[model samples]
Target: MKLAAATPAAAQVKADELGQIPVLMYHRIMVKPQQSLDRSTTELYDELTRLAKDGYVPITAAQFVSGRIDVPAGKHPVVLTFDDSTPGHFGLDAQGNPKPDTAVGVIERVAHENPGFRPVATFYLNKDLFGMDELQAAAGLKWLVQHGYEVANHTMSHPDLSHLTKDQVHKEISGMEDEIVKMTGAHTTTFAYPFGVAPHKPAWAEKLDGSYAFQGIFLAGWRPSVSPFDGKFDRWAIDRVRSEGKVKEDDCKQFCSTAWLDYLDKHPDERYTSDGDPNTVTFPNVLEDRLAKPYRAWARVY
Candidate 1:
């Protein structure tokens, strides 16, 4: 019997020509489930394990928005996002480290176990920071930023933007940005609409000042997000699919993580694929002009 050969570093995997990426939306990670938003620890671990086995590399929201995906060659890019600052989402242990079983803890652990798995994620938080004690909230926010994870805005109190006045909208969006800056000394550039509802009257995206301007805004969609490289990509209204085990009241068709993963498996060409080089992006030649200005310099014809 012959022994199996070692995998080569330069071997290329089948790549997604259009650069379509998936931004998975997750809420609470709890041991004991409560409500539809809460997911169990076993489920969370299983999902991460599946992603690793399927060649899905985690990227931060900032990287996805900027079109600067720098994962290893042959790995697909995916964004793992946690909404709200619930206690089950994140917390500190007795030694002041990230507690295991929480979303952040589980993510970190997965990355540790999987050598090439990137330990990056974006947390859209409200006024509350992981529902930790008031004194620990600031430190926790700072810790997330220092560790390369993104800390983004989710409004001051998670109110429905569609129902609020312009002034009220300003307070809700800018208030959280101000609080985050004051606490962690980090500026937030991304926002996720509460309840997936955009403002009905004055558009929030158009009225934002330089201090609180958002580069990307996310919605709670039960579908995959378009590539930032695509001309139809909307930075102000980016779509995200929910991460759950079963379809709930608000979930759309193919809402769960497994369904979306299976969808990608069925249509591998629609998923984002690396050219094995971070310096270059590979896509169809016809879309050459559609590449963002920042990424055009290194865009390669597939």
Candidate 2:
């Protein structure tokens, strides 16, 4: 069912299109949560289930940056971003189905169980290419793109860009683009900085002299992103919240996905709530100052 952003029923749902949206970053899925970045199969499954039950729908990173979101009215858009492209992130078994314990596997299961939960996500690729061989990586890339998943450049070597020279930085970014072109005959328009940190110049990641370009470059930050239509939005350094449970260290106890999601639930007006439409941005009149000038024509106030 299609829904317009300015529908009268939007009031009941408190559609705040100008509010923040969670862009959750994940690294790997494993049998054991040995590392802070690792999520067990059960943890991944349960977390996604919680998101679905809370009225969130998965959208690709490209869609989020391009502002092409179109989830049902009253349902918010959440971006599921898996970095490192680890072996446990995606794979196929004998029947060519996603391995049940992998990130994609868990997401597929959740979407199958929830009526409006879509099995879509963005995978950031590094040189290792999901720890698969050339043939396998090629097939995996094809499968992911064919299945509505977004594959983005995450540099050839996942080095901290801050330590690399200008030439090295360009190579790191362009090398990944070359791989995507070699495998898929196409290149990704979006990118994520390795370690979620850009080089000293930063602009190098956003573009490489005309050889490549990106619409958005994500960062490893500790908060939900401002709406793309908001004045505070930055395509070059969009903030992404790390996906993890409570932890007292690194301020994860308060800034992690689990904690922030809880806070958003209690303070519902702070998070972005869809008006079931993509063509317009709906929010209260008081937030008028927060809307970006370019998107002002699309803004609708209650």
Candidate 3:
């Protein structure tokens, strides 16, 4: 399969047209029966409602890859993403790992209640994280893919790609792509760099070659729309904005803060560039410093 670059149309489109597609990264939406994110179902529903009222569109992987984020195309075009292949997503087992039944239950309920707003989620997983049965993995994959969801790569063993050799990185990246395609019959192009580390900054690594064979649908690292082609490294880097727990109503008052959105829209060259420069000075230096520190904090764990 031929991997292609993002369309020139995307670049020409105004920030008003593209808007702020906040890719919200989440993991284990539902915790083990006894263990949870200290949040209740009512609370989760409220958060979703609040986001909806704020004009956030929970876009799907397919919609995102296709650049179809136009409806309710306001200031916020948030993408809801889930990481890890935990069975607890299905529900927890006796050992507290995810159970297929539990996880699918949460997804099914969400799908049922949302009607036309079927929230599409991406599952980045290790091949071995599923059940012992290979057929089960294949079947489970087919089930999710057939639904409105997409499965992308999370590496073979979930190692820090920045620290590994180029060949080793290729193995981890391509091996998982091969596995997903073999199981689901679709070309797997996206990859979440194991722990959000790029071969730059404190990760202290060099950039790797862009995949000539795989077309990445989405990945992690760069902020929305920024690419590595210009001067920055890792075009595969697709940055996500994270929302932790429930913030006060006042805290998120401008949840879809028009001012911030307006600034981004006006300064599209800084944030959403196809020119290939990932590191552009856009936000205030102090705030940028604050944001950069967290991403670094996030990458070190892997």
Candidate 4:
């Protein structure tokens, strides 16, 4: 419903009515989930299709934080968030059309097919991890923003915010914020914590908020606003149920399976809003799978 951010009435209604808004998180959208891949292409589409069929509205991170888009009484509102700027996300066609798998593609298709459902997406990108080179990446970033996606920060290098030194943390957050603003002319206010870690102290969270709009975190699960430890300040710190698997056949079923919902219900603590001075946490580098298709060659730098 295009909610205004500071309206007291809207905020109150959002708190009272919206049940746990399931924020669904995803990585790449490939037919095959890389060895380390959590979800295959079929699974991604299947989950989306089911969400459409089930009368789910895909709200952007902005809507989630603004408390707009009233959740129909007793309805579950969901936010679709994708992380990392991966090349594979630029979906290729049989004839070699370069269709980006950016959340825009998904939103547009959903809007077209489901007229009642308005689809918006939050794209969390690491300044250093873009699949394309500088210029192309800038173009791509601009395109995503132009098309109505909220480009939030994942950090300069997708490092664990809790692990870096305070200086490193500033670089990670401010550096990406500056790059994004320069490239797209959009001030990135929202940030997704690299690895979900509860802020050990309150100042860590305060520092982020003071630095930028710092809207929310996309961690795993379903959280209602009222519960203590509800992680609401992290309310901007939202939770997403992971959707990884093949979407075709039973894979789609698996993506939205009852089991997953049960899992989210059971693990409320896993949802992290902040940990203090995250720079103290050291993170290990892990390799994510890169696509090997010949079509990917088109995206290669000469």
How does residue 268 of candidate 3 score in lDDT? 48
Candidate 1 local lDDT, 1-302, one digit each (tens):
21122123422454443567889998888898887877898888899988988888999898888877788777899999989878877777889788997888998899899888888899998987887776798888877888888999999999888888888898888888888888888678788989888987636643467558778899988878888877678888898988875555555346667788888889887788776666566765555666666555565664
Give the Cα lDDT of each candidate: 0.79, 0.89, 0.47, 0.52
Better structure of 1 and 3 per TM-score: 1
Stretches of candidate 2 off by over 4 Å are 1-5
RMSD, one per candidate, in order: 6.0, 2.9, 11.4, 15.3
**Model 2 residue 183 CA deviation in Å:** 1.3
Q: What lDDT tens digits, residue by residue, belong to model 3 across residues 161-196?
A: 667776777667667767887898886545565566
Q: Flag regions of model 3 displaced more than 4 Å.
A: 1-15, 32-46, 70-76, 91-104, 130-132, 199-235, 246-302
- lDDT-superior candidate, 2 or 4: 2
The candidate 3 region of ten consecutive residues with least summed lDDT is 293-302
TM-score of each: 0.90, 0.96, 0.59, 0.66
lDDT of 2 by residue, 250-286 (tens): 7888999999999999989998998887988888777
Ranking by TM-score: 2, 1, 4, 3
Worst 10 residues of 1 by lDDT: 1-10
Q: What TM-score does model 3 achieve against the real structure?
A: 0.59
